[model samples]
Target chain A: MDAAAETTPLLSVRDLRVSFALDEGLVRAVDGTSFDVMPGQVLGVVGESGCGKSVTMRAILQLVERPGRITSGEIRFRRDGEIVDLARLPPRGPVMRDIRGGEIALIPQEPMAAFSPVHTVGEQIIEAILLHGHRWGEKKLSRKDARDITVGLFRDVGISMPSQRVDAYSWQLSGGLRQRAMIAMALSCKPRLLIADEPTTAIDVTTQAQVLALLRDLQAKYNTAIIFITHDLGVIAQMASYVVVMYLGRVMEQGPVDEIFHTPKHPYTQALLRSIPSMTGTTRVALPVISGALPHPFNRPAGCPFHPRCPDVMERCSKAVPSLRPVTPTQLASCFLHHDQAEPS
Target chain B: MSDTAASPLLEVRGLQKFFPITKGFFQRVVGHVRAVDGVDFTVNEGETLGLVGESGCGKTTASRCILRAVDPTGGSINYRTRDGRTVDLATLSPAELRPLRAEIQMIFQDPFGSLNPRMTLLDNVGEPLLVNGMSNRNERTARVAELLRVVGLRPEFMHRFPHAFSGGQRQRIGIARALATNPRLVVADEPVSALDVSVQAQVLNLLLELQSRLKLTFLFVAHDLSVVRHISDRIAVMYVGQLVELAPTDAIFNRPLHPYTAALMRAVPPADPRVRITDGILGGEVPSPAAPPSGCYFHPRCRFAEERCRVEAPALREVTSGRFSRCHFAGELSL
Candidate 1:
């Protein structure tokens, strides 16, 4: 018999590579990325606009639109005492569809677009609950049970008068309420992993604070693992226990939150941290820029994509890509500067 | 020793813009959405006044009214022209306002949407110059090159379409167009909110440099307090279409007088893991402008609300020297 997969990560993405075939050339959106999401842990994916964090997330659920394919890699996930490779599952097949929204749910950046305009928010959530009812331990969710569950989720997300709000359309509610409704929908089937992609970008700061607080509380209560993808480092600091910094479709560094923020190893990580205009800085003191703009998607640089803007670039950095190596016990970085520590992959 | 205060470049008094809420097929007017309700402020010469507010809070509406992009329902926008001639822009006719348009310009938020797709950056930046009677194409091109160079973009890229440039580069082009006419007052509405953090710092630094170089007075409307703190000499806090607190940047950040201002400060996710938004996160959504709550519009969500706050509206009054607040107990609150 196989040994228990207890010590293994809840989700292990090993050398995951996703590429989009364009008319002009191939765009490697996620080039050789790897990370682990521990059970009930908050992992933040931070990067700039074209950094491919969103594509990586879409690939996890097999939702990356065609022309963009997961060319090579393994997405090993522990499910129901068995390990499954999500990368191999047919995107439109029953198994993948079941796992997409059933076990792993997604709250998109724009909740307004994610929801249907014709249906009431409550109806959509109820439909999700009814569809995934069988997966829930013992009882199947009936119509009445689904409605009650929808209302319960609403209340859990701190929507006032959940019973009345259950009938409201997505457009009728305020931006904050719409986001809360989206959260309720995502959590309807009790997903083990919640993927929030720039979830707080649309709302006001005050409402964003409320939502972040709510998400933290719910994560604690359900002990559900989360993958939060955003461009805001401030938000990452407040939310994640571990951080994955990406640049031009690759992971530059990964480590515990404190070490990542305090003492980043990769030059890209260091430059990104120094570039931000902090609240504590002397007013009007010009912040240091990363020197050059992001390379055009089609014209991505050879070897390390960040070598052009990297302050401590070596001659060999332009020749070949460096594999991620453990710089410290808990921290990992992909840079030629740390090549002496281990053999190049 | 104290230096003399700069003269007011523009003063807005009791600005109100009401959009009617229509219901039936006949478009029967139900009520009014007082988007910018009885607001007042002044932008001194060469000073950046940061107008801070959450969405639907009327900060955007108020800035638009000042620019006359959306005509206001009432109140006067007093402007001091170059020759020391004071004019009420609110009452100016189209012909009268045409020349003054060259004196004031705007920088928009979305860099992508603001620039024309078909037109090259040269024509896009030069359009304002053309409109203001810079008829000679050669002169316009020369001036556009100078403006582009001033904003830190390579002048050669002006011939290229906007799609060829990145978000940061596009925003610089937008700034160049806004400064084409040598406008004295620039109304930048959430200019850097659409940009990435690294790029935002670059833009902020450029704006700071340009402000001193050109002696430009700015009405910087933005939502981020930290960004506002970096750029503005004074900050105004708006809630439900009314100014709750207005003070120097340091005063508002260090010792906010109003509860709403204090709450807003707490909402900004501190970039350190040691700190988190634990308590006093404002509950409930912002009230709709169409049917705002009675008395103090913020009373329903305000943690410090009392019986009196629910019954009586508070007028924006000068609380101390160079400070203003609309809260009933502005001075007494420790926050």
Candidate 2:
């Protein structure tokens, strides 16, 4: 991103590490990860399950659940020309409460689980606005105002019959409608950053396409920075400007979308790009798979986490972990092949 | 796909499965949800026929009906038996269906739920061999070991429990269990969907290789078109409870005759960034099966829907050679 140097990043994560204490051992879910989300930039985090993509996003929100907590990192968010470290804020503290819904919002993976089944969709969204209504910049925000805003957001997210649909309970609506409602709830407070975690994974493909299009439209209209986390590379191709490929909690590669897809330096990234079946992929031919399976959390490999499954693994990979470094002018990768780069992350 | 044009291994016609909605103290049936309403399709020998649809479209129910997991309300499932016998599976009594069970087996979607958690891999895979008249433990063990190796798993792991394996390994074990009876037809329901992309590829390639190696015919039911396009010889696109289009994989992907099929094609995000989705013709949700709209079930969401489509239901008819479509203006629309 040429424009990256011109302006400050909206959110900067430096060596973020999240760990879960289990009976087996300490599971390093997010191990020494760093990245930047520029203002209005769509940063795509792509990885398979247990790859720590969700943990990294949760770390940013300071919403790491029980048994898991951010071990060490600096999550610097640029708010009103000042950088505030989110890692320092308590999860339930006042600053986090404001930032959770007021500045940074999340469109969670499962809309059915996120929503309260008993409450009507409109009532819940209105409740969010009333709780953080001060961010609306209006002195006296009424329930009626919140209702109107909720209805408008419903319409903005492309829900049919917004007036009547708002009164329907989450269960009364179909999967697609419920997902739109979730997106509406996330954008209710005009959040500067939206963290969408596999928002379209549950819905039908046609509905998924519509949701992706709606998100793109909303992001453009609000210029809200978004961190789209999904395992689908096709979705990343459609929605992201920059891409981050993660494996076993560490960033395997990060670069412009085109570079990451075309000239992936990390063997893991290269193998991943080849493994998926695309719309235009050859039929019946065996996809070159990344051999072996993801290691158990308790048995995370020494040195490079992906060394066990990497196609181009080296002896150095087993002894020392490679730091994220520039492989090309525009791309950075963590591998022995690219360790010769001068600067290191 | 051995002699795929010669004969069909299974044929389903007018398959209908309805669940009643009971209400009040008396539990009076108010309405019926037509889950698999008058669906028809055929699978030839050694061919993978991809039965695909979104949720609530009855793909899973139809697959279940074939396995007799759930009894069908009405249908004729003419399945060719191993001994040159043809039988209507839908009408067969449970006692009669027991023997035919060896001919047809299912691979479930959720790897964790399908396999018994308490059972060891030996018991899980060998249970099928044991029940299918292989009572000798030594014989079952040898066969189970070979089956495990067939699906690319370590034979030694057969002694281990299901919890010890990863998602991909568990699915392989599931495949081994399904193939233990040496079934001719395998109905796999979203087998690879639960695994990661890399692991999903491994499983998919395994399925393809096993099909060709074992000469096994597959009724691959899934919502993913890309995977379907990769493994299936023919693709059947279902909407609501009926098939909207059925054609060869290439034809369905390249020149779909139904608007819904084209809509589904357009919905799949091409991995290339240049082919971004900015606009779509599909709108509205898939209609509730119990309360489907008049005429075509997909008209509400289809961009090519016309006045006739709103009042008159379309019949599945041959539009091109070996291609069937259910649209009033099939093959007429540019879609």
- TM-score list, all predictions: 0.97, 0.98
Give the CAPRI class of candidate 1. Answer: medium
- Tens digits of lDDT, candidate 2, A87-184: 99989999899999889999999999999999999999999999999888868799999999999999999998999998999999888889999999
Instruction: List lDDT for all candidates, in order.
Output: 0.89, 0.91
- For residues B1-335, write the lDDT of model 1, one tens digit per residue: 01213588899999999999999999999999999999999889888999999998999999988888899999999999988999988888888999999899999999999999999999999999999999999999999999999999988998899999988899999999999999999999999999987688789889999998998889999998888988888899999888988998877788888889999988989877877668889988788888899899989998889999999999998999888999999989776
Off by over 4 Å in 2: A1-6, A340-345
Tens digits of per-residue lDDT for model 1 on A55-91? 9999999999989999999999888888889999999
Q: Best candidate, DockQ-wise?
A: 2
Task: State each candidate's clash count.
Answer: 0, 0
Residues B1-335 of candidate 2 have per-residue lDDT tens digits of 54565699899999999999999999999999999999988899999999999999999999999999999999899999999999999999999999999989999888989899898999999998888899999999999999999999989998889999999999999999999999999999999999999999999999999988988999999999999999898999999999999998988898889989988888988887876666664777788899999998888888887898899999999998889999988878997
TM-score of chain B of each: 0.98, 0.98
